[model samples]
Target: MSKTKESIFDYQLFKRLFEYIKPYKGVFMGLIVLVVLLAIFSSATPYITKDAIDDSITNKDTKNFLFYMVLMLGVLVLQTVFQLLFIYYAAWLGQNLVMDVRVKLFDHLLKFKMKYYDNSSVGVLITRAVTDMERIADIFGQGLFMIVRDLLTMAVVFAVMVYINVKLSLIVFAMLPILLYATRVFQKYMKKAFEEVRTEVSNLNSFVQERLTGMKILQLFTRETVEYEKFKTINERHKKGWLKTVWYNSIFFPIADLASSVTIGLVAWYGGLNVVFDGTNVSQGDLVAFIMFVPMLFRPLRQIADKFNTLQMGMVAATRVFKVLDTTSQIDDHGLIEADGFKGEIKFNNVYFNYVEDEDVLKGISFNVNVGETVAIVGATGAGKSTIINLLNRFYEIKGGTISIDGVDIKEVTLASLRTQIAVVLQDVFLFADTIMSNITLNHPEISEEQVYQAAKDIGIHDFIMSLPNGYHYNVKERGAMLSSGQRQLISFLRAYVTNPSILVLDEATSSVDSYSEQLIQNATDKITKGRTSIVIAHRLATVKKADNIIVMDAGEIVEQGTHNELLSKENGYYKNLYEVQFLQEEAV
Candidate 1:
């Protein structure tokens, strides 16, 4: 499905961005004031030099020369102080703004529904959170100050030049149109080039992360050479994108330099002519001062042009970052109802769902599980089994019909309250890089250490955890890479168990564990599901043999459903065929 192309710098988006930095507005304003003061003092130096030349050097007034020189030196010192102050405050504001953005973006991401992750790339999102924020910081810290300081300096210099000689000022100012036109052209192309560079960099980062995470699989499959070649292609694309940016910048800078030089050369020629023709009215001192201010004008002009590049790049990054922030959490809980307790009864009535429009994954499916019933859903890989569970959890909204818990529509209960009542243990377990104890208590952080220990023991991983070098304090690597699959599963089981939820959903939760660990998980599952509605989606037929009800699904519809014996008695159904295949395989073993 095609996504909408939304501009990132819409007024509302920047208003929200400004809100994040509003607390630091004092420092930001201080930086602006410092920049303006520095620009004023810096721009005044040429006038001092002019007075020194006309009154001291040309007319041979030694006292006035030394006095003006001393004053100019003092002005230089003051400018430097203000410059330093601006840098300090600008850096402080930039760092604080970036931190606030990162924290808010991360916090918002955690609340996002699973469907968001399913649609977005991890690399793209990471770039927005990390790299994009840094770009914005650079814009705020250096880019913003440069823009303000240069514009103010340019304005002060132009006014002083016009006062010194309006005729010469108008001659010099004629180049403004040309400079602006060139800048406009450069800005247009540079914006496009920088956008491509940003996209390429995001792609390269994504490639690196994906390959690094799957390094083991790549090596085992002997696809290292193939992957290396793929990476080379990505790297080359990134290089080309960067080269395009360089090409534009290279052309832009030299042209800008030539334009500035021409402006200065024209001012010098015109001002010198006026000095010669106008004689006493325009002295050598005034011409020299005009020459000094000539470079100042073009310097700020050049800087303003350069700042546009930074601004363009920052705008591109901001666009991407704001795109994420702009996406409304479609599954947000709008219900005001808060429940102190939950009954495990769940019913899906005439429910329909689709990841894409006009393509139903679950078609008008209806099922009801009474409180404390252990129901097993069996299906082929894409038979909408997991989709049903996802819908029950409201991971994706249903197009038609209602899902309820104890006769209350799931939408009527706040998401936190609804989810707090359900615990899900999936086949693909993810454990954070923390102590075993922390992983177990992830869902119930207020649970005591004793409660954690009891939950771990109930899941039969407590002894194994204790046998480790650091017991419950042992650190797991990313996604629990430090532990065996069975150990990770055990931790996940404990995590679900400690939640003390009203409903339990296990999706091949024990498929990775050994027989012994499986037995332990099964025992824990029995305890946890004692008075809760439980939905088990199992690949292994043997795992659900004792389910109170077995649902066999095929092609997005339930083909047959009954207890294990009842389904086994039907010899021609999909469930019976699956059962016979497993039964014969076990016999051969």
Candidate 2:
């Protein structure tokens, strides 16, 4: 599933697309039968009228006319019935199929490594899953089957015309080649135009999403005017791409209509001459039928070109969608063992890793945390402090080394099992738009609401959560915007604690909050880290002072590892320098 350009009408793309139809194959076949019925009924209209005029009206037979009229009316009712059923089932199948694809796509995205999201645009991915998926629906909903029906009707109409009078049929088809050539040219340009349109659409969505998410930064810097102009430029390009398709459409349909009109006139003129002069060749009934047949034959051909817009856009959408579906960025699940645990003893042995190739972020890093021991990793940014936590949880693969839990290689265990035992509370806490209780339990059925309340009380945040507008049932509203930074951090701690994992990793949660909240977090940290194996990437000296061991890092390697007092005892050591600087800052404050 490499990302490759999919050609319009590529048989392979269609084959893959049709694979989705298996679940609804029975209904799909029923729709096809409906299409056949509709096309046959539509094509029989002119033939019925020809019989009514020639056998009933011309011969002055009132009973025959009445009978043919009844037959035509009956066929119309059947056509309507088939059409109603087709519309209902097609829509049903279209929406359900889209739902299945979207669900599978979302599941695929969830399995992808963090690196995939790091380099991919969120808005472009939305276009793929949401917008592009709708266009693909148009193919099954109407474009594909409807076009087939029209083509089938045209074939039947053309056959009847030739059977009625071959000379007049040739006159009608004289104008056919010119319209088909125009359609061929129209399709070529429309495909290119739509591809450009799709590109611009993705660009516009990406630009807007990025800007809206970063609107705070833009407003703080007063760059609204600059960004607004950029938005206009991108929007104008999107508009121009769509206008090109409109331009082609404007040129194409008129030519088709004109071709049909001219063909009708030619058929009428030739048929009229035979009717007025040659008594044997064409009748008045036949002349009327030829006029009716010309439009029927050309209408589908014209609409085929129009309906192609759906197919062309669908082709473009499918290409972009398949590219995302084909991305090889998901973290491979390598083994079969299911992990359940008692103790948390983590080991990272000679780990080498990088986000990009050939540039190591963690250089042969090695560390060990014993069972029930609390270790704090301390360093400045880019010293690979956070990278250690990332590797421990297998957020990213290590280039060289082994990370194991309880002496079992983490890769050998199922990811869901391995991850269930580890909980991480990052520096930037994220809360979903959900109730406080739901956020704490993460809707995990094992943890009851009673457990959530007890856990909140144990960690001493029960009063704080109860003080909110709805107690634990309060909706946080979009990443917890209604709560203060400290409030969000407290909620994250409660979330991690209720999981009751064998291992807990806190990525310096206390550094960004006010002093009161910091004190609360410190108390919660003391309570939760009592017996679990905890790794705290600490920013403040307070949490680090209590650690069983301190690992000091600098530029992707461990500079020192020892107790806080032992590190302070060393003269001119890395930890000594860090401790002295922090002490001076505290004294000055």
TM-score per candidate, chains pooled: 0.91, 0.97
Per-residue lDDT of candidate 1, residues 416-478 (tens digit): 888888889888889998888788787455888898888777766678789887998888978
Please give the CA lDDT of all the candidate structures: 0.80, 0.87
Q: Which stretches of candidate 1 lie over 4 Å from their true place?
A: 1-21, 262-279, 509-512, 540-542, 571-573
Q: Which stretches of candidate 2 lie over 4 Å from their true place?
A: 1-7
In candidate 2 the C-alpha lDDT for residue 541 amounts to 77
Candidate 2 accuracy as lDDT: 0.87
- Point out the worst 10-residue segment of candidate 1 by lDDT: 1-10
Error of 1 at 446 (Å): 1.3
RMSD of each: 3.2, 1.8
Model 1 / residue 422 / CA error / Å: 0.4
Q: Model 1 Cα RMSD, Å?
A: 3.2
lDDT of 2 by residue, 1-589 (tens): 2233434465677788888889999999999999888888886778889999999998999999999999999998998999999888887887787788888888888888999999999999989999999998887786787788888888888888889988888888888889888988888788889899999999999999999989999999999999999999999999999999999999999899989888888877888888889958888888898888888888999888888888888878887888878888866688698878748988999999999998888999888999999999988779999988787777898899999888998889888888889988889988899988888888898999888899999999999899999899999998898898999999999999998889999986665689888888988999999998999998877788899999999989999999999999998999889888874475466
